[model samples]
Target: MPLLWKTSILLAISHDSNILPAHLQPLPSRGGHIRWNWIGDEHLNKTTDIIYMNASVAADGTLTGVSDFRATKFNGVTWLKTHAGREGVFAFKGPKAFMSIPGIVLPQDLKTFTFEASYAPQGAQNAELIRSGDFRIAWKGDTLSIQNGANTYQGSIPAVPAGQWVQLGCVVKEGIPSLFVNGKAVALLPGQSQPLTSIGNATLIGSGYTGMMDELRVWKEARPATRLGRDISPTWADRLLYFHLPADTKRSMGEDKASWASQIAWIRSRLRNPADHMVRLGIAGGAWKDMLRDPKARQKFAGEIASIVNRYKLDGVDLDFEWIEGPYKGDPPARQWDNYADLAQRIRKAQPDMCFTISLHVVCYRMPKKGIDAVDYFTFQNYGPSSARYPFDDFTRSLAAFRKQGFPDSKIMLSVPFQGTGDAKADSVRLYSDIVAQHPNLPPTADTAEFTYPDGTKRKMTFNGPATIRKKCEYAKAQKLRGIMYWDMGGDVRTDARKGQTDYRHPKALLPVINEILKGRR
Candidate 1:
């Protein structure tokens, strides 16, 4: 009987070199050169001009990076079904396989830089984990080394165990670098501080290390050591890239995959109503405050946003502008508000067809009338605890206040809260979906949900159930308000629990309730 052997093999041959038969291979000649080639064509002409829409994009400035594999097909990385876990988390299994985030040119004027990701290694002792031009983070015999220009910083980190997840981070500030592992600082081999060379090539990950990575983030500001391992909030303004959630997998008008924009497209696809979707713009930090103070910066900012709106074929842009006045900026609150309105005017001038709107967070007196005129509509965020029922009196009073400020009833939108608050213990802020899943027999018209904790005590959470939602919609219609704006759709009893997935017609869902009341569809 003939001997049999079984194993898996990957083969690669040079296009310009000789091809050898599987059964026979030539031995290496003396002094012959050995070359390692990547699996994808490096010279492929691909455009990385497309912008990814994420929670960050909804609020912050323009960010350029690949949030999913679809954005990197130009560099030979395509979406594959074998990818496990949630969207945006990629699994790399081959040694020569790597993915590059295209069109990444490190801005030379950036004062600080930070890169971080959560990854699970797969026993590659010597492999490059991330590389961009001369900057590289690699593993050499279980030790991690970071290199930039002529400087190499090797940290005294423990042996990286193969199947466990580790949050790795590196921050470079004023030519000095710091390494963080799992939120703790690592002792580094000292070397002279040298400013990193600006990266002109694409940032590549998993060049040789076979692993799984998720929650990749990059920042133009070198985040302090305290915030190294903690997940950055979605609204952080300094963030250059935030690929943390499921919404990252899709584009604004991409026909290929699902995204926030795609979800809006999906809604319009099913409805006869000419619904328009606009990306929200706001920021959680001082970036916006500083930018608005300067006339030139504000103009450039508005133009960039208008360009994004045009490029993505979006309906328009919405301003969730908050934090206009703070002690950090000595300018009076009224002045900042004026600057904000001026920014709105600039944006409006750039794209006259854009449906400009704003989320009303300030008092009517502080809100600039000019800004109100520039916007097509405004959503009043009347947020408070609905201990047992929706605050009908407060809601009406807020609308009256806006009206006193010259806000038209037809241009005002009512805000609805889908998340539970007050009375519920342990998890006070529970999603409507979780509440519904806990009590199947609960009535959609009910205003409060009761839950029993492990301690045998029951607590009631007051949220806007279908009945409350319908009541608000009816009030909006009766008052001649523009429309109802749900605080968020993600917290509802979605047909699917994943982000960006919505089943608008679910009996207990708030959306269908609003539709029934406002659209007369019941």
Candidate 2:
């Protein structure tokens, strides 16, 4: 429930018995009240296992929690009532609604435990998502920050438009704290041997939380990153159909709801392979953009991605952390790669079967073997203004360069754009289906095409037609690359008014060609 995108649905969906890890095999079903390991049972009354709210309120105003806890949603707080079939939903009225649990303060001798919850942020107004006086998670306008007494840190997670959700968890052992969001470990504060100072007041979910919450779990153990209750998800098979989505918060580009969420959902539910389930619908972009250079920022963003996949139940995650040195080159580029490696390592530990992927930007394309080791697959873009990977411009060079650099072609998915381009290597930039619609006479040869935008300006562009795509696919097969990929899901097709999504209009579009070439081959 904590958006454990690390989820397997825990059902016998696949016939392949050997694929699941030992922990994921067919198991007993336990309701929400399993007493995980309460070594402090003798001190039950002395112990402060208070439950403010376990992400849900029953029809009788009861919380589905463990023994020795009763969550009371005090002061006339209303439920969101739109839970999407989850375990719990708590809706707060800014500044008015707050839940508290008393006796959680540990005795001076205690030093280990876990705190976790699934929370969604719905606005910019200052409010605490969850906090004790000694530790707090809050949103100050567009940014999210955490505090432990006077020392505070902001998470690298990007700002979401009014209604986006994420999970947060923290494990404090001997006073050293490791924080997590959406199942990925984010930060480990310094001073492990010190005592965990208490919050003078009590454990509270107050200040300003304007969204639903669920699966509130706590454990009295020094749980390792691996045991962080990361729900497992299904795996992508040899054939991968991935989309690089921008975590576009504001829904820009004349779009409505988060780009392609509904579309991808449509694909997952509507389109299945008959043998396996549907495609392993994944997302990229957002949170990882500025994470390449800072340690805490990297940790914060790592959890952000994990949280997203968990919240959305994506099959996995794909990354595009582009800046190696970035503007001014102030940060060490090598360390940036290390941060990402840590991310993959931590998240994979929680959800080993989930597919993890990384993208290689052409200009500065180079990854340590370990970083590559962290992921299930590696993809390199061959299209851009550089005119390097585009078949219309010249397809041979980019693949050859990757080979020349000793890359494992078996792991590399040669990524291509599904749209046409112009300018000093790139421009006209319209969907492949749109290109066909505009010029019925446009041939499959690598020829220059003209595009007229709403501005009434025309630009000559080099387009990858059906013939070129087929050739590229054949070339990839001959070279034994992983597979061919388009830049995104929306770039190949035109928007459909009926479903408020896009439709595959032309059979000759490169997308169709890729699917055609890969059909039954894997």
- Superposition TM-score, candidate 1 onto the true structure: 0.62
Cα deviation of 427, candidate 1, in Å: 9.5
Once fitted onto the true fold, the runs of candidate 1 whose alpha carbons sit more than 4 angstroms away are 1-99, 103-127, 133-135, 140-143, 148-151, 155-201, 206-241, 244-286, 323-328, 362-365, 385-389, 423-428, 449-460, 495-505
Cα RMSD to the true fold for all candidates: 17.2, 18.6
C-alpha positional error of residue 232 in candidate 2 after TM-score superposition, expressed in Å: 36
Candidate 1, residue 73: the lDDT equals 37
Query: In candidate 1, what are the lDDT values of residues 1-522, reduced to their tens digit?
Result: 111100000011001011100000000110000001100111000000111123222123432221222235322223323234445545666566676655342334333687777776667556667676667777666577887667777876776677677888888787567888888888778544346555465666666666666656555567777776573332223234322222234342112131234333332343232221122322222366667678887787677767767765665545545644454368887888888889878888888886566656524335678877887766566543435324666677777788887887756766666567655442455556667777777786776767654467667767767776667667766776666555443455655432223344466765446445554543
**Displacement of the residue 38 alpha carbon in candidate 2, Å:** 53
Give the lDDT of residue 24 in candidate 2: 9
Each candidate structure's TM-score, on Cα atoms with residue i matched to residue i, is 0.62, 0.48
Best by lDDT: 1
User: Candidate 2, residues 103-189: lDDT per residue as tens digits?
Assistant: 332222335656665666566557675565466666667555655555555555546555556766666676556677667766443
